[model samples]
Target: MNGTLTTALAAGLGTGLALIVAIGAQNAFVLRQGILREHVAAVVAICALSDVVLIGLGIAGVGGVVRLWPAALTVVAILGSAFLLTYAALAARRALNPSAMPMSENATTRGRRAVAATCLALTWLNPHVYLDTVLMLGSVGNGFGDLRWWFAAGAALGSLLWFTALGYGARLLSGLFTRRRSWRILDGLIAVIMATLGIGMLTNALR
Candidate 1:
């Protein structure tokens, strides 16, 4: 009801929307699985649910903990870079292999569980996700003083909307990527994106 609250909400919404645009491993996995029509609902559910949990933690003062332990964040940053680099290398290899097939069927429950586990790892293991969703967003919301809750609400809502749209809509373009060359291009792009993000994180950590 106050100006501070309004500002915080606006800031949170803006930050969430902006960050969601970046295609990370979680988003890529969700989109890829969605396009293949394999466990589409499950993938979207996991992505959205994970965002909700992380965003809620951010609003609950988790950022304060992250800020207090700079060394821990530095370690996370290095580890995240390593993970991203490793993933990028794997993606590059996949691109080089032209025999790859799109995921075509809903996995068994156990297989779905495995995929969920992988998604959880991708969502939580990367320091960038924590830094962006928890520390950065939470810190900014705290700056709203009396209106911090509104900002948190906006951010959470933004994340929910983004994951829903992205995870489902990617299927619309499934036809385009059914070709072998298209898979190669998509994998190549993913590899480049991951490597670039990893290098950027390493640079920031060093500085």
Candidate 2:
């Protein structure tokens, strides 16, 4: 690639990673799935592919359309908040119920379809994803002028790499999570994170 394109790609990579690395509902779900060794591949695939699609749309200037439609985001925010709150309640219940913590992969481990559904909801329903991938990243990519696509490519690659690493690397913590107390702590933290994000979205939508 040319110097300008290369610079754009580098900028895209940094921006993508910086935005995604933060702790959020999606990341929390991915980490829990990784710990349980349940449908990790599918979850990772959904997340990575979702990012690719969103980033592509952003590069195509769909961000402008999003900016024009405030009600669309408000709807998404409401739905996302409901989903996040529901998941948070589940997580909190799990944290309180020791019996819910599975020592081994069992039927209670989420099935592929269920996991896929949750993954899609967590990714698509979250308005923050739109803001980050579609608005922020899209705006940044547009700054690259003719090299915007190159920037999108870099951002997509960043998503692929980060999700792959997070999904797979979480296995290294498998040993640590084998204990019941660990599961409690994990679910508790997830509950807090999810609830906070959900409430924050609800508050933003109300305002």
Candidate 3:
């Protein structure tokens, strides 16, 4: 309500969005789900909720604990890489197989449970989420002193808005994806993004 609060909130909003708008495995997955019109709500909710929790923890200084335990992140990095690579392979196969596109007659809708699990893994398993939301946002929020809660709220709101728009707004573009080549291009992009992130994680974790 105060000037400080407003400033912190705005700062948090801009910062939060900037971090999430980057090209990454999570965004790619969400975009894919959105375009397919399959499990969009579930994917959006999972990603948004995960960001809120992480933002809260960061504001609460839990990033310190994470920093003290390097092995924890290493484990996550490894697991995340494996999951990403697996998803990449699937995506690549889809890109190469015309009948495998989600819009195809033979395409299958993944179960909600599977979609939820994949969303969770994409969100939580990535070490960059920890670094950006937990460490970066947490550090910045805490610097706000007593207004850190407002900052967190702003960040949380940003997450909710971003994922919601990305998930649902993707539908507007769904019409464009009806063509087989469109789906192929999308799947191919997803494959490259996921594989690059996976290999990067694996390389970082090993070193």
Candidate 4:
């Protein structure tokens, strides 16, 4: 690629990776699944592909149509908050009930369908995601003039690589997660993250 396109690609990759490679409910879930070694591929695929689709829509300016309807974001905000808070409660319960969990392979796991649905919910329900991928990324892409598609491709690739690394690389932590106390700590952290995000969303929507 030419220097300009390469610049756009690098910018997109850096921006996208910066946004996604941090603490979030989705990352928490993926990390947990990775530690469990259950449905890791499916979870990673869902996150990566969903990001690509959302990024594509944003680059195409579907976000403009979304802006014309404030009610839509408001509705999504409310729903997302509720979903996150509910998930937080569940995670708290798991934290408190650590005795019920074991890291053994034969231990019960969430069914593939259930995990997929939750993965979708966690991905699609968050308003912050729309702001990040749609509005923010779109604005950045537009700043590139004619090379925006190259930028979009880089952003999408960054997301895919990050999720793949996070989901699969979590196996390295299997040793730590093998302990029940570690599981409790993880669940507690997830609870806190989810609750914070949920309350933040709810308050913003109410305003």
The clash count of every prediction, one per candidate, is 0, 0, 0, 0
Where does model 1 exceed 4 Å of error?
A: 1-11, 103-110, 203-207
User: Residue 112 lDDT in model 1?
Assistant: 75
TM-score against truth, every candidate: 0.81, 0.97, 0.98, 0.96
Error of 4 at 139 (Å): 1.0
To one decimal, what is the Cα RMSD in angstroms of model 4 from the true structure?
1.5
In model 1, how large is the Cα lDDT of residue 143? 75
Q: Backbone clash tally for model 4?
A: 0
Give candidate 4's error at residue 73 in angstroms: 0.9
Query: lDDT tens digits, residues 1-207, model 4?
Result: 789889999998998998899899999999989888899999999999999998888888877867788778889999999999999998898888865565644447789999999999999998878889988998888888889888999999999999999999999999998788898898899999999999999999999
- Rank candidates, lDDT, best first: 3, 2, 4, 1
Candidate 4's TM-score reads 0.96
Worst lDDT 10-window in candidate 2: 102-111
Query: Candidate 1 on 1-207: residue-level lDDT in tens?
Result: 767667777788888888877767778877766666667677777767777777777878997788788778677778778877887897798688765435324322336776677667667667777788887887777777767778878887887788778877888988897687887888888789878877887888878
- Cα lDDT, model 3, residue 6: 100
- lDDT against the true structure, each candidate: 0.76, 0.92, 0.94, 0.90
Model 3 scores what on Cα lDDT? Answer: 0.94
Evaluate model 2: give its TM-score: 0.97
Strongest candidate by lDDT = 3
